[model samples]
Target: MNIKPLFDRVVVESVQSEEKTKSGFILPSSAQEKPQTARVVAVGPGGVVDGKDVTMEVKIGDVVLYAKYSGSEFKVDGKEFTILRQSDILAIVE
Candidate 1:
């Protein structure tokens, strides 16, 4: 399955969460926090959107940090993904 965003939208997948804490305490699945970081899966063409000339700052394969509870989540081929606007992406990880 191919996911292509439109008009400054971005598709990303959550990075894996830590199973153990730095103190060597193991965390269970229910205790794990949601991952704020994700890898870019696909990007939309930056055309005019919402009366603004949007230029895409993110590209495919970029790692990014987003709001804790942003975007819509879906699954494709048993893999999870999130779709959000470019503005929702906070920063790109170098």
Candidate 2:
């Protein structure tokens, strides 16, 4: 299945979170935090949003950092995805 975001929304997939500490201690799933980094799978077309001229800065395949609890989550074809506004993205990983 393919995803296409509308307006300034973007679809991203989470990267795997670290399950172990740097000290070689393994962390349990209950101790894991929500992953804030994700890979852009699809992006919306840049255009007028909420009466403002919005432009998209990130494109598909870009790795980005977002707020810890931002965006909505969903699943497609057994894979998880998140849909968030462009502004929710904090930085693009170079």
Best by lDDT: 2
- In order, the Cα lDDT scores of the candidates are 0.94, 0.96
The TM-score of candidate 2 is 0.96
lDDT of 2 by residue, 1-94 (tens): 8898999999999999999999999999899999999999999997999999999999999999999889999999999999999999999999
Could you tally the backbone clashes for each prediction?
0, 0
What's the TM-score of every candidate structure?
Answer: 0.96, 0.96
Candidate 1 per-residue lDDT over residues 16-85, each given as its tens digit: 9889999999999899988999999999999899899999999999999999889999999999999999
Q: How many clashing residue pairs, candidate 2?
A: 0
Candidate 1 lDDT for residue 81 = 96
Off by over 4 Å in 1: none
At residue 36, give the lDDT of candidate 2.
95
